[model samples]
Target: MPSANGDSTRNHLAVNPVFTAEPAHIPRNTLPGDGLAPDVAYQVVHDELMLDGNARLNLATFVTTWMEPTAEKLMAECFDKNMIDKDEYPRTATLEHRCTRMLGDLWHAPPADDVTGCSTTGSSEACMLAGLALKRRWQHARRAAGLPADRPNLVMGINVQVCWEKFANYFDVEPRLVPMQGERFHLDAEQAAAHCDENTIGVVAVLGSTFDGSYEPVADICAALDRLEAERGWNVPVHVDGASGAMVAPFCDPGLVWDFRLPRVASINTSGHKYGLVYPGVGWVVWRDAAALPEDLVFRVNYLGGDMPTFALNFSRPGAQVVAQYYTFLRLGFEGFRRVQQTCRDVATSLAERIGELGPFRLLTKGDELPVFVFALRDDVTGYSVFDVSAHLRESGWLVPAYTFPAHRTDLAVLRVVVRNGMTHDLADLFLDDLRLAVERLSRQAKPLRGAESASFAHGASAHHA
Candidate 1:
């Protein structure tokens, strides 16, 4: 009994098939050697997400990438979940309502009449909605004024995000760009006014330029538009694309009058994922009043028996992100948000100051201007290029974007760092330390690292000239 039982147990424990029954030719570990295993990629991604508590503050382009456990848990709950329960989540409408109210108050919407807004997947969709609304309103105004409908255009700075171009392309409207020069990085009031005529639908003044993080002097733009309106009798309105700066500006620069306080600004659109401190796939568009939102744009859908009013380009979005945004508003009240933004500003300023001492690098925009800081190689750094330094930084796992200035400033390449949530002082220090190391390494390199000329490889440019 012992012999048979032991033999069978030993046989079962063998790592390979029994030689007694099968031919022995292959090794047990023989398998294809793909470069990356799925499990390994998953682990690396998990590590990256958890780095700095995922509060690395690396995303200055937006508020921050959401990595809070609460956000993750909420997202998991919403995956593959339906959002059409009229009975259970009847108060679900309150989610959008609450966000609308918060943004309305922050943006300083008028005290009287009904203010209208909606949540979108991101600022891109919000911009699309804003453009569509402006177009519809322009058409109505044109019909009322008995003007020729042949031409309708939007005036904006060349530094505007690509979405503006897409908006014009999608609606068949002319995109009248106010080109940027060396001294002027935003849409000049003079240039913007020149583009406006009876055919102009709206002038989009960016509160925060995506390229430089500069505010486009909304007050000046509005005042200039007012003068044009009085002189030309043109009723063109202003739309503020505050995707990156909307939330942070209120707390950091409360005196800034880029919001609804400006008489000409008809609607304000922002990315909830950016400064709102929510995860991606959440954006908001707020019209001054119900009258601003076109009736034809809002579609009444009868789902789960009751009719629900929907206006977004894409329907059937997950409710989890919305719930998460509402949670952020509740969790981080006004004071909390201000404190967080202030922390980012302070850390970014510190990094800027530290980097200022480094040789051959010039600060393009002051860190205090916004959380984003842009830098370029100084003239004294003859042999070394910003592009070369960016390649060095990449070796150390930094994702700082470097690129050339748009249009007129294409000859100059710059680097930019976006300070987002989870970017603590310590993390900033680490980044600076790594940057120093990268700089030293690049200095010791034998050759210059020039970026590829093609747009496909443009990611390399974001590092040195972002």
Candidate 2:
């Protein structure tokens, strides 16, 4: 009985609503609920508060936040490339050129015919591409040298990120691991050279190690490779994995020649998100020249004029991250990056000094190269261990991760602190206070198995079995 305007009509069917099966093809115009509702801004802001309220020391891994104004500008402007054009926006290409030039200058590379580089999702993909390039180049050189192609191998540290192992596994090459030991927490140049034979493709030198935030002696590694190549009559190259250190050393320690300046270092890869002060998911890799990246490794895609060569593993990532990185370069310049890095170093040193003074723990790495600190419980702590202290710290809301040292150093478990940009002095003090409280609380607790009989049984049973 209702008219078209009434609730009973098709346009006004709410009154006698029947939950029919969704029509075979519901018209776009006749949607029911608001397609997009529930704004997430408030929820996101709430989460930030929760994160801060909990232990805010955040030495777990390398994560960071930009300053308010800087973040606002990055989010607002660079995210939306309204002015960019597929035809004219050559901004992608332009940004690539700019970054390549800047990195070349930062790493001190001589001008050459084939200075090539690409932006990536992160250092992982960049590393993959570097590995592929090395593989291809080695194959090409092998054919020319009339050497057997079956025994291709890559030399690298045992403590290397799993990506290196995956690279070798995927390429069906031998991963000649150079073991790390006391005073040698990185690839030993002599040991790595010893693994090299006619089939050795390249040696990966880490500019910054993840475990202890130390630099592998790239100069010494390069020297070793130089000697090997001279004696073997085959070309061997060095790939610098400068993921975190590349960004730090340029500003804090400029005199280092670990990059392309070293004769044997043919390529370098870094995570822009790590130390470049950009958000996650941006990385870079640059070859000394076009020759370093074999031509076969590049593929021409139909999207960007099939004639243009593409080097990246990922195809359609948001251009926003790239623009943000370029913006960081323009806004911070060289001096700004240096100042920020210097501040990070100072803060790290200050925290290390404070931790040292507090007692019950000893510092691991001297905060000189990278702003990361590792510490272990003092030798005298009887019932408690570093792991126990790590658990206590977590109760206070800090997300510090505790793990055993790599390979041969499994006996030594240490806690690491990675000081990112956002952590302030006040936050550091709070973390220290919580750490002290954790130690004191742990010490006060009596051990469940304090008797000599209990101790004797545990060790005596093991000895009896042996």
Candidate 3:
């Protein structure tokens, strides 16, 4: 009924409506009757995220916060692909296998050709897989020796991440956590050896501890286990939780003997998303040899149109992170990784030195081994605690976490900072400036800073479980 021009006008009117002065607010708990425009929907969600702490200023998390544009493109391209479907995405599977082999070689696996490993959703899943293998291997050995495998246990420091506890609870293994004492923040060889028996599945040695970022003595633990084997006939293997240090120690400190070079370390798990310089949701676990991971734990499935050997806790996950990991490996190589890690270490060391000079703070760990450090307020400093400083630092959008030490050391509350790849020296300087200001403000306060008591209590509770 309309002319050509009128029809064109009508089509334009339908396609592009005038902006509404009062846009409908999005429902918080229910769906809307109509969908919003793409840009409006994006704006609404984006605006909400502005309340979050900037990832760049968050020194609390060990996760990687930045990546190359090319890696981002690669990740975006493969987000829809499922990592478990090997037949559909053969290249991704090949990349995953290559990454495993590379990590195995990096860890100095004895039989390079026979090395076995896999990609996990994250370090937690990787840890779970590693724990399962140890449990299964222990059970098989017990059955072979005509012994009971009912009372399996895992030995680790109280400083271990919560994932270890989850692994123990979810898989029916008793956690024999070694209590932390004064000046001894991690599991020692003597402590590890004393906790082992025939029922012990394995000892978990953290290369980079989550509590204070110190590398536990991996070699010493292994030697103690060796001695235990000779004296009591109980051979306990070791699994290194190298979440932050696996990619670090190899690149920064090449001479470290914490990996496959050690006879007792049967397996290791590292976060690809952490020091490996990839985004979140990628982890790697590698065994010293194929025999280290029991065959019963691996299940052969033909569901995705071909036979695939799946050993991960997660059935389907985004293959994008694995691709990003491979991209990083190719892009960085050994020298590039070393340079980045060394830079971070330098920054951490410099910060630690400066913080120690502040008079009111004492250095716990000086970022000597890993690119992370912890500091606590000097006991003489009254009124303001480390928690007050942590709270005040948030005013400048910095997220520095303050928490107490585990078990016997609950009284030792401290602040921790993780210097990751993107943390430039300039940003470090800014953080130091802000930290000094925060300390000065807290020092001048008449009474204990607000929330100081609650923060102390909360950290004490957390450390009780640590």
Candidate 4:
């Protein structure tokens, strides 16, 4: 029977005969008088989900689309546990603790028991926490010296994720976003320094920029901040939003001096679900040391039995993702992780190279940095826009995104592809064939056929969640 929710796959035969009196139409906006049988309810939701695009073929997102069967099983087992209830689920909490320790070491923070970190819902929450830490630390220093901490500001590239914008808005901090100028797509040493003032709380340097998947110059930005302190006595800390790069750079680009190896970096964050090779909704943030994060922000609760010190924006989230992260860490040690990331980087660079050879495309980034790349149509070959190709690819179940650049480069429109863990050489080869065909077919059009769907494409703060 068809339902008001528009689910036509509802089998009238209920899992239990007693529940056969299930209503003809499933109530969507209103609470149901009686629930449907388990099988019937499951079928109704499952069938509708089939309309979604193939996850394995989704090139628009940096999130992981696949994991091993064993990891999946482990996640299923831990779904019942609450991450916030540290006392009840001691082992789960321990795993979370261990992951932070590992990340601190990975980022090369000084060996100290007080270096604090926590897992959040994802990188967005992690960023917010890091921002709060930066703001609080700055406030404390100013107050101690009897200077008014009223006008706090944060500096970052225009390409930073939306979470940072939210932090500025919600917390009443002024955002000094360095705009993208001609030939400069992200925050550079000179631009970053120029944006800072005595009121600046901290500077954010993205380890992996969502706009083009290139790393902003964290080292240069830090050095620039150091110069600001020495020259003007304005000491500003740096926070690396390594949501994608934190996991990739360590294993792939071993010598990158973007982490705690730089003295001015106070904090760093990463999405465990992205390049960390786990499923969705797990993130980590590590402070250089306990001093970087103000003490008053942490809360200790004994209501759940043992007194636990916690710092997170979320409460009572499923512990499955954290458990999965621990399993991944144990399963793939240093060398194992190195191989997986290295393979992904190789696949991305190879795909980007072949994509550039497909006639009309010009590469903005080559995927060597973050296993991601952006490309745009050449000026001479202008029959259709990149959005036209994005819409075309969606018809074939691929979700490659197309959006224009921000600020000064708003004139430039392009398509971006994120090559994640499961993207194999075979899939890349298949995508190239599809892209070749798409380009050849679109060349026949006399003018642009930009669809209304193209209006939805946006980059930076508006579309950072993707």
Candidate 5:
């Protein structure tokens, strides 16, 4: 028997009707007694997420915010596949290998049938893996020569991403960070040479500094290490943290020699999710040669029904991101990637030009290298600070981050904007308008901004431009 309001053929039954009407009140902290309808649960979560900052308008992060519809479809389809299980999902492994080869070739790896590398959860894991390889290789050489393999140390600038610090802490390597000063915000060859010793594992040269969108002098650092090796008999390799620039320099500035083109660059790591034009959570680490990555680091496991050599920090991650990366590589070949990166560089340059014209700000980096830039308030402009302008921009849904420099350069506070793939000239123009308005609003504030003094520590305190 069906009611007059109900369809005669449909069964009108409810397992838990209590939550069906008032889904908004669903307790988020604890598990419910009974599950609600799928749509109801989805709506509750989705509605709450609507309040989050819009991804497209976020200028502080270097992560990709958009992708093609086809890439989205492909990622959705392979979301359930686990990347670690090479036996069950062999094709995913194949795709990963192909991607590695492509990256190796792109980075100018010597002509070889296979390259040693792996996909990571992000640039952080990729960096960790690269650090491990460098450490192991150094240890192997030390042990062969009957030298002390203990007290391994890594060298980099204070401008390095925090992941490098994490790598040092987690892996028992000493972090010798070079302090940044005035105009020199990156690790120079002299600074790196000063940090080297017999116990030094490797020198980390940042291809794209997260500080001010500048590319560290990789070749110069390598040459400095070469001289150090000749003088002190301590041979140290170079690992390029190409998180953002690896993808850009290859296309935008082909003349840049920050990659394997330099002989001493043993390994390189890049975020596939950043400038690689893919969504979040994908990174790569490619060694110049198979010998650069020690055999002991790769774990050979047959638990997945095949002999698979795994060399990653995490296991059982989503293979969909890797697939999306492959899709991006295939869809956007060399020419396509070049055009996209060139356009982003152009937009960033244009924005930098326009923002520099604002008169209150002094351009730190001109966004000519990696589609990113940083600027500081002129000393003459005393009424308002970058923090105030940052706060005002938030009202317009723009997430421009303002923070002080690290270590020796902490006195200089600046604002940074990371222009990604989807950011266009029109969006840049709109952002400029909003930025101008924010500056205007900040100028009119009667008192100092709420928590203005502490605001410098809020956003990019630990994180640099990238």
Candidate 6:
């Protein structure tokens, strides 16, 4: 047996094993035969994480990067709790229900004693649930009408988040994605109604488009749908993919009629971790009423499982985000959320204005709607593309993204910036300074780098899908 002193020395984690002449190098592909000391293992992982970008300076993502210290503490405390274990943690479940009902009220669901909604891992999962519901409801209607539902299709803009595509592929529903027209980066009322028929299950309206952070005309889309139903007898519902704007418009643009006020809107989804002012990996979905979600109907896919049950974002996701969302609701109330979101809007618009004034770029959106904006290089400036500017900004610890428009507008490429809660006025000024210097340096460069290093970062709505 080894001596007691030897065992003690081996167990001591305070010792810096890396400082020794021969450093330890273990393959991470397989489980190690030996165990490491707790503190030593922690130090190794912590050091590796130093390579991550500063979240506050990250302009590419829409997820929340800053939270109150108290919120952080609460999230840390509940990290061990699983959302699926509702029976074991009754209080957490109750809080989740309360948050759901609160969102229902905020979205202006029809006044009722019982509201139907749920918390999700994020908007992706919530969107899946809502899409499933739409499909099932359409199936029921087709079956009742003595018609075949074999060719079920969903109408939506091509700019929708990737999750919708995944949902359609998985559920075997045909996706009727409306393509973008010239100068029309997103879907419009005419395009949405034109794609509908008897087989159309629902139409998706994006409250905020990630391409330009502009709101689609929800009321106009609804009116078109109403006319279609009156003319063709096809009563199609609308699903609002408000992953970012559902939390925004009710507070910032209360006059905007995009939510439940439009009876055609059957469901809506939002990321609580995005504009809702919480951390990542949390989202909310609310139905207009109990009839909107066909929860009682059995949906079975035998290859996966004989009798598969459906769920929202709460299956096995981190429960702490839900707790953190509850804390935000209680701590901020309605007015507090408005102030924080408004501040973000102010920063976004101010920064966009300053960037437009730089003379080398053209303004696409003012950030007045979603606290996000996109700008393209002026046609006369040919020395550098938006990709070069994006790559150069990455050097200064900023992460503005540059990408080309989809479909009909692929010829246009632009750089985008998202002004979140922590990006204050001072930081905006610093960003403006860096942008000016970048333009000047790249303007004088010999030739275009062809956006050499821009591929490393994610592109378009999928990056900010939250």
Best by the TM-score measure:
4
**Model 5's lDDT to the true fold?**
0.87
Could you tell me which 10 consecutive residues in candidate 1 have the lowest summed lDDT? 454-463
Query: What residue pairs are clashing in model 3?
Result: none
Candidate 2 structure quality by residue, lDDT tens digits, 224-303: 87888789875789899988899999899988778887878889999888788887768889988888999988876443
Error of 1 at 379 (Å): 1.4
Off by over 4 Å in 1: 1-63, 83-88, 112-114, 302-307, 445-447, 452-466
lDDT of model 5 at position 305: 72
The residue-by-residue lDDT of candidate 1 on 111-193, one tens digit each, is 85545888888888999999999999988877878867768999998788888888898889998987768778779788889
Ranking by TM-score: 4, 3, 5, 6, 1, 2
Q: Indicate whether candidate 4 or candidate 5 has the larger TM-score.
A: 4
Instruction: Estimate, for each residue in 1-466, the C-alpha lDDT of model 5 and write its tens digit.
Output: 5557542333323223445454433554457767777877766667657988999999988999999999999999999999988888889999999999999999999888788899999999999999999999988999999988889999999989888888998999999999987689999999999988999999999987877899999989999999998999988999999999999999988887888888899999999999998998999999998899899898897745757677988988999999999999999999999999999989998999999999889899999998999998888777777888888888999998777788888788888989998999999999999999888877776645543354633332254322
List per-prediction Cα lDDT, in the order shown.
0.75, 0.73, 0.87, 0.88, 0.87, 0.85
Kindly indicate the candidate among 3 and 6 with the higher lDDT: 3
- C-alpha-based local distance difference test score of model 4: 0.88
Angstrom error at residue 61, model 2: 1.7
lDDT of 6: 0.85
TM-score of each: 0.84, 0.82, 0.93, 0.94, 0.92, 0.91
Q: Flag regions of model 2 displaced more than 4 Å.
A: 1-36, 40-56, 76-89, 301-307, 446-466
Clashing pairs in 4: none
Model 1 scores a TM of 0.84
Error of 1 at 57 (Å): 7.4
